[model samples]
Target: MDRMSAQKRRESVIRAAIAEFARTGYHGTSTAAIAKRVGVTQPYLFRLFPDKKAIFVAALMRSMDDTRLAFERADDGMEGGGQALRAMTGAYAHLMSTCPETLLMQMQGYAAVAAAEAQGDDLIGEVVRAGWMRIWETVHLSLGADADETASFFACGMLGNTLTAIGLPASAGR
Candidate 1:
């Protein structure tokens, strides 16, 4: 395949994989399913990612990075946590309108993590914690809080609020 076509194919697969993995979990998502979704075969999917796990990991990493970047960009225009969160929420609401699949994938990942926890697996938990700490640290710095206790104090609280907001969006008025 040509370079652009290959790149497009990869993106299509990733998008489809995100939805599939989100719906099916990492273990349940099959290469054939993703390939079929991307209008290819199982072997072609393998050409992009050696295995399903690798693709799921890549998608999760991309999601985390994208969230961080979005937060930073939205935060840049505001001076306080409340204002920043408003902008961030607006961005999220906009995203919710535009790219709902990304959000759905994230929600699916959380569900998969919960399922993993039930099965005595902690991979998603560790990954989620690390992703959270990064966000909390950023929020702490934004708040001009003491760095020494930031992770445990502000970061922890912020992380809790975030999960809560995501989990209880309707109840939280988010």
Candidate 2:
């Protein structure tokens, strides 16, 4: 992280925040811990981000963006069909196994956005939902623009994330 530009440092902080928040969720994680993970002072983190929620939002957006990329890469230059869906699902399964923290971050983002909306604060909800819609649209288009297919894919993905976050196997029964 040495000799990096301010923008680079900010990116590093976002990455650190993702790991920290993934483990502890939005309310449970602190800016200080994120700063420590980035090897910077908490005030420096504040310089990079306006506040804790801002950091959380950045991390949430990045996670969703990455997920979108996964689907895109899986289906790139291919016609929409069952094979593309299988490739995307396999890519997602690999992502879940390797980046479990990312899966946890997705779960946390949903809860945080819902809570903020319940309190009459829709800014975070809007930001998070925009990122979510990008991912949804990516999958929707990749799944041949079938609304039910898109919805079913996301539903299964959410269930997988829930089980992963709760430390349960995908196959919970024998």
Candidate 3:
């Protein structure tokens, strides 16, 4: 196979890493496992990511990026928070139904957020906050939520139901 560009290599590793993590859980996945899946060597994996934790973080960031895009696309032509949230939740729920194991990715990301909250590490929680902030802006003050309250509602509501949506009826996604 032709060598991949740095961006492609990075993305390839992240995808493989997610697959590994999803199947094996964060602690069970090994760098060798990720490298083998990516068709690269352990050293190559390390070159892309310093360690397994780094790989997990990279994969988590990609998942968050996808989640953000879901909200962005959901907001298109949607009138208010309820509508935008329905669209977003539908997209997320569809993902859960089709790929239930991606729930592992969701869990790891949530763990990152929980840890960050305890230690004041804002990076992970910021991902959840940013998506909710957009929802807040789209809904406007009519929802009676200031930014903090809106973010809390989102963190507690939609984000909390992602995994639970698995095995929901097909109508849930639609």
Candidate 4:
């Protein structure tokens, strides 16, 4: 088999890490599992990432970037706040249904933040908060910079995430 480049291996590790972390969370996931998923040895995974925390952070960042791009793409060439809002909403819904792992990884990121903060480790929280702000800003601008509208949109999105995490159908309370 052909050998993968370092960059490609790193990307594979990140993808595998996302799935593993989504399933087991930061505290529960082990580097061995991530390496196994990526078809690499644990030492090679470490060479790609300094430690498990690094791998988790990379996965979390990727998930956030993916989300931000989804909103941006959905709002591309759209006019009017309501129209952009609907487009972004549809994009998010598609992401939820098709890329459930991303959603799960995002939730796990939030949970990991709280866990890390309690132990006086704020790095994870910092990364998550910054990433979240990027998403918020993207939505805020796409929604015509209306603060109330942006808040309402995120409020609904968070609720949706919670519902999905709990295995509630999209039509559960409707």
Candidate 5:
């Protein structure tokens, strides 16, 4: 079998890690499981990532990048904040339905940051906070730079995520 490039292997590992972390969270996920998911051995996984924490961090960064790209694409060619807001919200809904694992991984990443900070590891928390701020700023800009509007949009978004995460039926909103 032909060997994958280092960069490709790292991407694959991050993808697999995202899914695994989504399912089991940071504390529950293991490098061996991520390696198995990637069709690589544990040592090979470590070679791609310095350690499990590194892999998780990579996954978090990938998730943030993917989300930002999605928003940018959705808002492209749209005029006015109302149109952009609608487009971005629709895009987020589509992402939740199709790539729910990524959102789940994001939630896991937040929890992991809190846990890490509790253990005197604030670096992950700082990175996670920065990623979140970027997302917020993206949404804020897309929604016309109104502080109240952006806050309202995110408040609704959090509610939507909570409803989905708790397995609420679609009819529950009725």
Candidate 6:
């Protein structure tokens, strides 16, 4: 069997961290759990990431990047604000269905940020907010840079996230 390179091992660790963090928020998850999930020792995991917070930040950033990419892809070659908005919405819905873990990780990241902020720790919140801004900028530009439209789009998306987090089905009202 070929031994995994440090970079490959790091990638595996990030994937494992996402799953573990999605199931349990940052404060609830342990480095041991992430390492075990990645089939690595704690020391190896530490070598890749300085600590649990580092792992969580990586996973959160990755989730945000995935979301931004989906919107960008959906907007590609699409003309007009309405068309781009619809395409982006559909892409988000597809992402929510196909990669629920990403959404779950995002929710967990939000909770972690809130908790961190309440305790006077701004590191996590800073990182999460920056990642969120990237997604916001991607959507904002894709929707023609209309502030209201972008705000509305994100408002609806947050509502969707909230409903999903509460175990509500998309067809709940139908």
The prediction achieving the highest TM-score against the true structure is 4
The TM-scores of all predictions, comma-separated, are 0.68, 0.93, 0.66, 0.95, 0.93, 0.92
Which stretches of candidate 2 lie above 4 Å from their native place?
A: 171-174
Model 1, span 1-174: residue lDDT tens: 645577788878888887787566677888888888888888888888888767776676566666666657777857855566566656555554455555556655666678878989787777767776676666566545555544444333344345443554422432
Ranking by lDDT: 4, 6, 2, 5, 1, 3
The sequence of per-residue lDDT tens digits that candidate 2 reaches over residues 1-174 is 669889999999989988999999888998889999999998888888998988998998888888999999999987897977998988888888888887788778888987999999897788778988899889889989999988888878877887888898644511
**Candidates 1 and 5 compared by lDDT, better number:** 5
Relative to the true structure, how large is the alpha-carbon lDDT of every model? 0.65, 0.87, 0.64, 0.90, 0.83, 0.87
After aligning candidate 5 to the native by TM-score, how far in Å is the CA of 129 from where it should be? 0.8
Writing each residue's lDDT as its tens digit, candidate 6 over 1-174 gives 999999999988888888899888887899999988889899988899998888999998888888989999999998748999999999998987778778889989888887888989898898888989999999999888999999998888887777777788544523
Lowest lDDT 10-residue stretch of candidate 1: 165-174
Candidate 6 — worst ten consecutive residues by lDDT sum? Answer: 165-174
* Candidate with the greatest lDDT versus the true structure: 4
The alpha-carbon deviation from the true structure for residue 132 of candidate 4, after best TM-score superposition, in angstroms, is: 0.6
Comparing candidate 3 with candidate 6, which one achieves the higher TM-score? 6
Q: What residue pairs clash in candidate 5, if any at all?
A: none
lDDT tens digits by residue: candidate 5, 1-174: 998899998889999999999889998999999999999999888777778898888888888777777888898888647899899988888877777777878888888887898899987788788888998888888877889988987777667666666776322543
Model 5's number of clashes is 0
The clash tally of candidate 1 reads 0
